[model samples]
Target chain A: MKKIFSILFVTLLLFSCQPDEIPPIGEATDYIPMLTGTWKLNKFEQIDADAESKSFPAFATVKDLTNVFPGHPYTDFSITFNPDGTFTADPGSSYMQMLTSGDWEVDDTEFPSAIILSSGSETQTIALNSLADVILGKVEFKEERKQADTGKIKIKYIYSLSKTSEL
Target chain B: MRQLIIISILIFGTFVLKAQDALPKFTVTPSEIDALTENVVIEFDVTGTAVEGLTDVYIWSWAPGLNPSEMLLCYDQGSPSWGSISDNAKLEPVAGQPNKFRLSLPKTVTRAGVEVTFNNVAELFGVGDTPGKIKEFGFLLRSQDGGSGGKQTPGDMKTSITLLPLEFEPSYFRTFPAKVSKNDVVTAYLNLSLIESSENQKLSVSDAFTATVSLLDENGTVLLTSEAFETTFTSEKEHAFSFIAEMLGAFPEGKSLDDVSKCQVVFSGKVYNQDESFETVSTKVFEFDFQDYE
Candidate 1:
């Protein structure tokens, strides 16, 4: 009887050592559900769109801020989007453009192309460059600042964020 | 010995570069003057010329094409010769400025010491009756006598040349967005009035005029071509097609449009015969004659 018990215990231990198995995932809400979580800014890229329009050879006036530069506070940024359409951010030690916090809603729930954020009377749009990667925990958003009067693109800003935790 | 040789080479290169930088720069007002334009203005910034204070400046001129044969050879009116240029080539100094001088082409006014009056470009360059393309009016500014101990601009300082705009009458061709790049959308236009009676009759019998365009490399090699777009005289005179410049070339893997060294456009049009046989009766090839940044 004791040997039988010991054999059963060893069998259970072997099964536990096996790697985790993820069930098949399908019928996802895709964008809004994936965005309802905490995200950390992984990278920020900027392109001088105006100079590029002028056909300047320096159309590559692109800046990808991965490594923080002195006096340029672009690191340590985090934001959270909730399922109820409310959002918040923690600028932390870096200065973040205060446009992220407020009631946020994607242009579409299934396949969002933009994230429209509204604070009081003003509303801003950030273009979603691609479908959210839930498995990889990554999302890409782009913002284009334009000349107010001329309505011409002056700068193109891209934000790559990684999911830090579930809200 | 090797280190000494390296040091000597570096010193010599530095001296040569300094001398080249000190050469005079000639800036033509209205830097771009069409061949048909008159009243040419020449401004000389003599801050770095070999001569000091620029007391007495002189002009030397030439017709760039045919040969570097001298032009404005009115040194001695009745018997003008290159040898007598020293007496007639002197330029007037710009008022209070010591390191500046000016020369007006077409010789509108007579200078204090100079003795020649050219009414027009033909008289100034002595074009006479014969006609040929004078691509550029070459020049080199110099001291009163470019002899020993005289200050002068280097051989490289030549005047800007103006090319006559290429235009065939009745119909015209042009491109939009003067600056073209690999990624931008480019439009090619061909005016198909077929306005002339003979040309219109030819287009009327056929269906329409066929126009096609090609993207060229720096060597004028056709990199890529576009499908022929057609336009009829009765429909509209302005016919155009738009496309992205990047779609032209097939670059190697990982290489893209940015690798394009030169992006120039070559557009051509064809008119069919009056018999409705679809045989090409006339073909016109046109280029963006204006400067394309290479």
Candidate 2:
């Protein structure tokens, strides 16, 4: 009886010390409520990348353009995401291809990793940047530009939006 | 001299007129290295370049480091200082091969009047943002003697300095060259960044750090000593002090540099006590037996 009790106690202790599985935080629809606000450009990065590495290319340097052009056009950039599936942007040359007003929808109302935008007949998809403040709703994404013939990525423009204001 | 020039030009003309496959390749062997102590071979084929058909070529090279504005001569102090580096830095033609030449570099080179190890070499070469992180090394090929006409490679030849990240792990105290002659301009390097935290804290509040050197005989008898001199702080965590052994006056005044065998160095700083009084603190004497490179 004593031997059996010791074995049972040890087994119970092992089960108690088992690792906890953390549940994924927030559903895809959570992004909609958190993103319904106007956000200003807080950080802008230009990554000069080496496009030759096959598996994982690297950037030579990441230059911070936050304060370089204090009164310049890009600093005044802002965007607003509304709850009605519409958005407005004042990119101000901050990006080569950006829309001022468009109807938008996220691919996953549950996971919400990419956003699709349409204006008239033109449409584009931009992925969410999970490296920075992605799921937390500060709203970050990067545009990687590639060479025309080679299709190899050469430069990256990373934007992290901050100073959010909700209606 | 005129005949030599005419023959060189003739050879150059013949090589240029021939059907060539491609532009010559200027390269460095073992371009990437594990340690700064490793030597690299700079090789080039002069098939179509301006300096084609030359018997010998001189190398004029400098790795950019310490100062961002200027290039530091890549040759070590033990090699040759600037202005007289031609013959000492010439590239030799590869045996049995027609147009190939190579210059094998020493592990350490003199820069800014100091013999520096490769860790310092990588920093000086402007390859990376910090010491021991080297990306590339570049060089220019030239003639042994400088004048109107000399053989030289076209444009700039660059080679990667390391295949893997050559990290410099600081041991707190180091002497450049690892070995030194009596008159060699010995440099002492002090890195306080990785010292014991408490000792590092004591040095942070000290007025200034100072160093002294003692020349000892083989039996370990101190023959001469130098006055304590303040070291130059090259960076927030790095300091350097350089001296030649023979320059100082001997103990009573006339022992030659050759009589001195072993060399010992000490670094000191002032530390404050609990009573608001300060006392002198010093490193235990670190010594190295001098080599007869002469």
DockQ of each: 0.01, 0.01
Instruction: Report the lDDT of model 1 for residue A147.
Output: 52
Clashes of each: 0, 7
lDDT of 1 by residue, B38-84 (tens): 67776777775555476877777766654335655434444334344
Tens-digit lDDT track of model 2 for A1-167: 99999999999999999999998786434566676778788886655443122112122134455543323435678878788989888867443246778988888876777778778998877667752354355777676655545564555567778746785
**How high is the lDDT of residue B225 in model 1?**
59
Alpha-carbon error at A39 in model 1, in Å? 99
Model 2 regions more than 4 Å off? A1-29, A51-60, A67-71, A92-97, A131-137, B1-294
Clash pairs, candidate 1, are none
lDDT of 1 by residue, A46-107 (tens): 65553343233331345454443334345588888888998887876554555657899988
Clashing pairs in 2: A28-A110, B64-B124, B65-B124, B75-B110, B76-B109, B76-B110, B77-B110
